[model samples]
Target chain A: MRQMMVGVVALSALMAFPAMAAEGKRVSVKGELIDTWCYFSGVMGRPDAVVGSAHHTCAMWCAAGGIPIGLLGEDGEVYMVLKLPGDDASNGGETFLTMTNDTVEAEGMVYERDGLTYLVVSEVTSNDGIPNRTHEDFGVVPGNVIPDAVVDKVLEEG
Target chain B: MRRLVTLLACAATPVVAQAPLPFDIGGSFSLVDQRGDTRTEDSFGGPSLLFFGYAQCQSICTVALPRMAEAVDLLAERGVEVQPVLVTVDPVRDTPASLRDHAPDIHPRLVALTGSEDALAGARKAFRVESEVIGEDIEGPLYAHGSFVYLLDAEGEVLTLLPPVLGADRMAEIAMGYLEAKP
Candidate 1:
């Protein structure tokens, strides 16, 4: 129930984006780099709550598990991110794995098809790492993402 | 309300909006299917769903493969022929013999393919998919690989790519839209 309550804040762009061509449009976008699966599937939490410092660890797990990263644009569009600069593994690259959850300004080719958007980031023009610190509000959206042992250890230390 | 109605109508009918893929993603390659039969991109005689992952992979492949199979089944129910193909990134464990054993569990019609490491690497390169050895568990060597499913036409042209995050229902809906223009 808590998961449902927290996760109801839908990313409107997921369903709102209309059909468009596959032509690559060059644009510089400012947004949070996100784990596409959790954000779309809503298995973690709400769109606003699951991003930033709150969902960073789970984002790593998803990235490492071969889940595609996405750039959630400030306008509420989620661009399914392909390769970023200096890392073109075609799978999830090391660069994207490290940059997940970090809010950044990325310039790239954007393509929209079948009501979905995609991006191939040429470079991250600027990065303000994880400014949307929702952890204070949501406390690890998907509380199980962090192991109880680790949480207990942190609590014991305090 | 009107927009929703129009979108639903477009999806329910044949849509001529077969937009070109944004990237170069497929090519010809000779690989062995689950039946130990030598097959190439031309082998699938109908619209197809293709993925790049090994039979033993426990990562994203687990998520993507089953969803692709389900989409294939949903299309089948609607009398659309869509072959489901998996070209393995782990050629070592996913040989024809092994794929034959496992393909039925995923979907009876699944055509899981594998080949020499070099041959498999070429297939991945053509699709722009990358596979790297991450670590191993008792089950086998795990790999991080491309998890997107490619929707292809009879001639093996990639119509579009499906993100692994999509559910089978949405995947089928998207594929159905593309397919209505075919015949």
Candidate 2:
């Protein structure tokens, strides 16, 4: 009888804890990886702001600065990119920095919260025919433009 | 039976866990409005759309402010009253005079707010937003901030968060749905 009671308590405890099951569906999404800050704010003021190699440098800097990256699907769905559990943090962004401004296929679990879709990327594969512009070609490194004072302010405020 | 009691507890556990929790988005804010009047969360008596951006923001704020105004007009046309509010992300630059000038251009009904850095920071914290100055130029400094159009109830609790990408019509529709659904 005690053994049965222990089993019941264990079951109740397991059930009481929040579900550890991964939220959302696992699917492959194809789109241009974008740093959502400039993408949504149109800060770059470029017609090809969020997509294409021209926006690469700006997007990279933004993503590296902890701005949430997004995948702009061809169907107009914007999937906010999130790092999967136990992913390497050596690079500020896992797949977004590497795949910025290029059309790529990303396999991930997608979660929708407050009308925003989040893509927790597991794998990334780049597509062909997208021009991978060099830093020289972009001609502007946004990282260089960020003043130390600004960085200090951000750190202080945060 | 003991087995039945155990099974019932297990079933009830998940249901309680799955129940949606309240959004902790907004709270009381003491700030100065466009006219330099002190306003709190209770200043607005009905549903209000609250967003944070700076006047100097060329990208998102430019598009969002006008869209917010449009949403207000749409709501008015439908006979649903909603206040559109702009809380400055760059309070240092967006003074009361600047906000007063800039706000009326977007919408007659729009209320632009600014305050001391501490006050603005408190408001941002209450709204769960982070605004950081990222770059500077001849024009001015640029800020990268989390941009969300928050729809609030009469008491200032966040009802829903609308993405900046949504157009005025869509925002109005969503706001109306929330308002109409309320008992």
Candidate 3:
């Protein structure tokens, strides 16, 4: 009888926490992409580049290039490619609407692929749709967030 | 799994032409840390362990910042006051506010700096670092930039360099060794 009660209580607890039950825990991955070049490079191989600084530059870029778009998940997982409308592009292809400020609360399973940790994202959305904006929104664009100082230095040395 | 991933990444380095060395430390630039204070070559007192990165970066920044903090704690145990200076190669993006937001998560003492593209270029050149903007693709708009921790003396001279993949203990050893040794 006591054992049955414990199991019932556990089941009740699991049902109570919907968000926790649905949303998988997220882990942040902060590094530069060292390799996996040819694979991703081909995804947007077309020479077309949307040039301009508007609110929808990323939208235009993706549309003009037909490139898949998504943000790097906090869990270091690859989220599904989000398709934004062509009208999503602002003037001059600036701003970019695809996941720009999306929080991407995802629920999924963790997997190890090609030796690296990967989270197979199931669902994603912006947390506030405003707070997640990166430094790019402020007109301060990063050539590369992870400075290639060491590699550059190494190359320079040889 | 992490180790295997790291090894594979290392082995896959494309055969690119080697670059020249004995990089410079000064050319032109200005930056600000989490405290909103401007950091120039002059502001960095004592020996500085310089790391070029941004707050938005997830993997290297998250792992390295905490490890750096732990390393600092270790150095403190040995009676050393070493500063972990982070200079953002992505100046146009990183700002005093952003650094402030990210600093607490990394380490309170982890100083972040940023400047203009010209300034960033000069600083990277001084250190001979490289980074480029990649467009959107299946993976993402990743910055295939360099990753390494640079050790600089009181005079801003390069002491030692560690790649991003190195662990905290190794970094602590390098940092503690230099702090103990007077050069």
Native-contact recovery for every candidate? 0.21, 0.01, 0.00
Q: Is candidate 2 or candidate 3 better by TM-score?
A: 2
Please write out the lDDT profile of model 3 over residues B121-165, one tens digit for every residue. 767666545555545446434343444566655655554444433
- Could you give me the TM-score of model 3 versus the true structure? 0.45
User: What is the C-alpha lDDT profile of model 1 across B1-183, one tens digit per residue?
Assistant: 232244334334422222333346777778999888998877788789999988887778888898999999899899898999988888888878889899898889899999998888878877778678878899878787778898777767666678898778778878886676455
Show the colliding residue pairs in model 2. A41-B60
Sorted on DockQ, best first, the list reads: 1, 2, 3
The candidate 3 chain B region of ten consecutive residues with least summed lDDT is B14-23
Off by over 4 Å in 2: A1-32, A35-54, A57-69, A73-77, A81-158, B1-23
| Cα RMSD, model 3 | 22.0
Query: In candidate 1 chain B, what residue range of length 10 has the lowest lDDT sum?
Result: B13-22
Q: What TM-score would chain A of each candidate receive against the reference chain A?
A: 0.81, 0.60, 0.31
Docking class of 1: incorrect
- All candidates: interface RMSD: 14.5, 17.0, 24.7
lDDT of 3 by residue, A1-158 (tens): 01122122222322433222222234333221111211123222211111112123333323222222333444333322211223221110122233343444544444221112333334443243434233343331223323479538856999
Q: Could you give the TM-score of chain B for each candidate, in order? A: 0.87, 0.85, 0.75
Complex DockQ, candidate 2: 0.04
What's the distance in Å from true for residue A97, model 1? 0.9
